[model samples]
Target: MGLGKTLQTISLLGYLHEFRGITGPHMVVAPKSTLGNWMKEIRRFCPVLRTVKLLGNQDERKHIREDLLVAGKFDVCVTSFEMAIKEKTALRRFSWRYVIIDEAHRIKNENSLLSKTMRLYHANYRLLITGTPLQMTRLLDILEDYLMFRAYQYCHIDGNTGGEERDAKIEAFNQPGSSKFIFLLSTRVGGLGINLATVDIVILYDSDWNPQVDLQAQHRAHRIGQKKEVQVFCFCTEYPIEEKVIERAYKKLPFDALVIQQGRLAEQKTVNKDVLLQMVRFGAEMVFSSKDNTLTD
Candidate 1:
């Protein structure tokens, strides 16, 4: 998803160094393949910030660990997921300014080795970046605290919000020069009864069970009279219940089914309770397999 996540993160580091005087020990854990790109982007965009790459075989890493990898010596440490796990003890020594994870979906399952290893390091702030929608609902749950700490102006509405209050918030958000930067709402609550043509970007942090519900939510920013191109980002998990739900939802659409002669849709039926139950149970096998190997192959 060449969506500039790398550049944006580099810019943030640059801001901290240039403005805040926080020339820091920020650690970035990414895939082995992207480590070079991360280093390149940082040098290309923010050459002033010193960056050290934590990579190589055992002896090379030992050399880096002894000489180049020290606090106050480098602004950022770029490393891969495999290196993080292997050198967890060495990396954990520093209290980082920020621990940023790229391709964060790799840690969607909390039980994963990479996910658990990432938590062993200490950081004032942790940022996870991924194009995929993985555990975005959990991400949204933490935004309130993060936004409050950052003092960012934002408005929110949920099922509990009254119609008048919701409309007022929308009006405030749509007003030009308004300080509001984010509007948080539940899909069912905000899907149909709102128009946010003024909005240019929509982040679907929560995935709806029904595809239509998510589409309607996207239209809030893409309605008539909208000038800018609406960028809709849907955060969904790869496997497990959410993925299965999305798969079932799309398969339910009549247009997705095979249309024979005379526009006759292929024979299909709504997912039954058993099918729904199976979808819910789809990913539980991993948990069970961890306990008893006989439960799954």
Candidate 2:
């Protein structure tokens, strides 16, 4: 976990400014807890550039927005997910040179309030930091990330319930001890930004393509502000595709699942290339050979 990502990022920002001649009024959207570290690193390493921490009470934040938007005073702005949404009216005014997100899982679900609002911020270059592989060489690596996010909205049904309905659900779910509230929600929409900390348990009625969405659903109750220990449950039927989803996730991250879920890692290996080809061929053959929806294994 301690991969020196912050140091490396500060290095890149400095390099781009000094040698590449890309003097940026960049934006960094990070967790409230880590916004200090982002600005601190920039100051400690790249002190020449003026960095502003976009936080404060409502009034202070309003003034900071004027500085960044109207005055265009700072070289970089470090803000949290909440402030990005709250300040989007001003944040949208200037096109950013870079929009970097720390712990990008915050916006893993595209239609979530914070996720959508972050996009309204125009950025010439976008960056996301996740626990996944980090290669500082690629700044445009965010294009794949952007595609994946947009694809999720199209794939998840309840994720499309944008605007007021989504806000109402978040508010209701965050209330302390809301009894008899059976919130039927999509895996993506139910996961991001909302303070589901008061929720005692979370039920994932189905899985999403990215295992991250599945993990996000379970963490809804596991976050800060929760009164009781949270329990997470996921259900999948006998479908082959459903079984494959879980198997692949556990296989890819056996150690993470072991600690996080308190489950043992099943002995797993890579699927054979020939076997994968056979599965693909079988699906194609079934589609052409029969009208039946079920493919016989």
TM-scores for candidates 1 onward, in order: 0.52, 0.46
Task: Using lDDT, give the best candidate's number.
Answer: 1
TM-score of 2: 0.46
Best by TM-score: 1
Once fitted onto the true fold, the runs of candidate 2 whose alpha carbons sit more than 4 angstroms away are 68-72, 132-297
lDDT of each residue in 153-268, candidate 1, tens digit only: 99887666788988899999889899998987767766757988789988876667776777777788887879998877655555446656655555444333322222542344
lDDT of 2 at 65: 69
The per-candidate count of clashes, in order, stands at 2, 0
Clashes by residue pair, model 2:
none
Worst 10 residues of 2 by lDDT: 135-144
Task: For model 2, state the Cα shift of residue 32 in Å.
Answer: 0.3
lDDT per residue for candidate 2 within 121-198, as digits (tens), equals: 888888887766342212223433554665531111154567677677667656655542444555666566655666
